[model samples]
Target: MEQAVCCYRHQDRETGVRCSRCERPICPECMVSASVGFQCPECVGQARPERQAQRPRTMTGGAVAANPRLITMILIGINVAVFLAVQAVGDSLVQDLILYGAWPPVDPTSGVAEGQWYRLLTATFLHQNVMHIGFNMLSLWWIGPGLEVALGRVRFLAVYLLSALGGSALSFLLANPNAGSLGASGAVFGLLGATFVLMRRLRYDSRPIVAIIVLNLFFTFAQTGTIDWRAHIGGLVTGAVVAFGMVHAPRERRALVQWGTCVAVAVVIVALVVVGTYRINH
Candidate 1:
């Protein structure tokens, strides 16, 4: 490095500090603090250098986030917005969006059986009342952010949507063909399941999450006539499997196992939906 008389960015301002990345002379105003010494504004704004030793990662191989709660907040916002839409639009929106294996079972004119397969996932977002949305969103907030931080954004989102899909798939298979169900309970349970898996992975005390799960499962079964326990159970099992892969896969082949778990779960969801649809129609 050549000795310079003044800062690279400002010839008038002299400085002794050099950017750790680019090794350029920088003044106090232009220099940004870095893990090592200092970095110029441009270098600081760029993505972290590919050097493995300097790269920061979350426990399960996710890039550390500046705001871990961003995804959770977005999910909550979406749920609130959808709930408001349901309130304003009335029963028609509910009819169109609610998850059903088949509607008017004798006629079999609509539902997953009638090629409206999107209901499997969309129904998870449709909430009919304040209490329903309130509890589910609260559960999501409590469980989602930490998992998002640990698993990274894309992987965390995969767990959520897939869990929801798993729930819808099971409900479609097991619930009455004419019956309708909607809620984020499946995804919430999924997040809870994933959280428990991570706690076990880290060898932390697992009793708290276990207790929570047992309590929720009891609540689910207690209301079985009105509630679809299948969705909750499906999401729970799927999330646990996914999180196990996320936290336990060998570091050398981590990406393969993690994504393979997601793909495999997705295949199962698709299969369940197909079989359910076939049975409903026949």
Candidate 2:
């Protein structure tokens, strides 16, 4: 019977309802309230411009997605997957992916010095300890979605990656060459910083994020032996700068300024890495 078939508009959706006029199977979303049963979307004849007008939009000029948290969830999943893989493959994975300066004082087999520059980005995803991954993922879940919503996926992703790179670059510049680090802490801190900037842009109360940042900073200093404070501070600073351009750029020239800001930040990050490496090797 018609009731046993799938919806014509949404094949994946099984439904018993059929359009009164078209007599086609219809899902709830495609069904329009009518005099009798329900009319299919096609029968109602919604205008193209009307549908377009109904589309959602992000605050920063990106299209609002149905699932606002999708990117955040994906990031968390990747972090968790990497954590589990580490548990299975062994601790060596951490060394392979972690951000570190030159090694052996002369003969470097691994690290950024030996042309393993991918570590700058890869290190952001590696996590060995359960507590470490747990905390970072929690922070990401808490901070990422809202920023993602405000900035939209592409800009949000740009900020995240730049923040990660910024964190890695600074860590390599200052932290012990041998004392490398790994985790999503940098990206999460970026989101925190972006959140603070966005709150200011939207004229929302910014005190909450500030309080959280202050608390995290205190812990960073208190646990200097464990926490990579350089990455945290670097990500925070980078995220804020990137987000400042995102929310403040003029309407007519927004795209140019926003992307220009990212490119400029990236150049600065590269310069930091180069200068830091030169100092380390010298």
Candidate 3:
């Protein structure tokens, strides 16, 4: 005989419906319409806890099924993977990815700069060594999620990437052309600056952020040769500018203003790089 097909709740009433979540047989009377499909009462009751467990969490909100800080996690993963690859391949990876001050600029080692301009962005994903990557990754982990939540994923990513470019542009203008620089320091500093601006916007006590920034700046300058102060300052300034635009944007025109601000900042950074490069070449 064919297996009996009946509602779990009402065996006497045969029905084709099933709980979408648990796949248990359900009668038309027991069917509860959901966004996707019908569900039984028991499944509906269990749904809340299941959703809570399945959802990704944001720093200051209820769990949502949408991935929280997904970009931040991806960034961390890429950096870690690059670090591991670098460990395996050695200095060759660094040489290819490291940001030199300027393309076509004179260099002692290679005689002339041959690295492509994309190195500016790629360099942010590269690191000098374990300690360097460790500190930068730690800073990203601390500041990334909260900022990601506040800005939303795309905007947060924009701030990070633009800040990295800003840092590299500044390094191009200021650092010795022959010197190689690499790491996520610029992006980490960008997150710090964004956090500072956001805290100020929310009228939260921003003194602690200021203190952290100051402490970091102090280390940046004090370390001299080891630290790239130009990159730090550039990233900080870019992130602050972006955050300021985000905070000050008119409620009715927020997205436009924020994105426009990012575009404007990018154009300015590019112009600066071109001008600096021209001056250096001439």
- What's the number of clashes in each of the models? 0, 0, 0
Specify the poorest-scoring 10-residue window by lDDT in model 1.
101-110
Per-residue accuracy of model 3 over 1-282 as CA lDDT, tens digit each: 877799999889888878888999999899999998999998788887977677663322223326667988999999999999999999987887786665444532321233256877888898887899999998999999888887777778889999999898888767776678778998788889999999988999999999999999999999968788889999999999987887778767877888899999999888867766565556
Predictions ranked by TM-score, top down? 1, 2, 3
Task: Tell how far residue 55 is off in model 3, in angstroms.
Answer: 15
Task: Using TM-score, give the best candidate's number.
Answer: 1
Candidate 3: global Cα-lDDT?
A: 0.81
For residues 25-98, could you state the per-residue lDDT of candidate 2 as single tens digits?
99989888987889987777854567777787677777788788998888888888888888888878887887
Per-candidate Cα lDDT values, in order, are 0.86, 0.84, 0.81
List, residue by residue over 198-230, the lDDT tens digit for candidate 1. 999999999999999999999999999878898
lDDT of 2 at 117: 80
Pairs of residues clashing in candidate 1: none
RMSD of each: 4.4, 8.1, 7.0
Quickly count the clashes in candidate 2. Answer: 0
- Considering lDDT, where higher is better, how would the candidates rank from best to worst? 1, 2, 3
RMSD of 2: 8.1
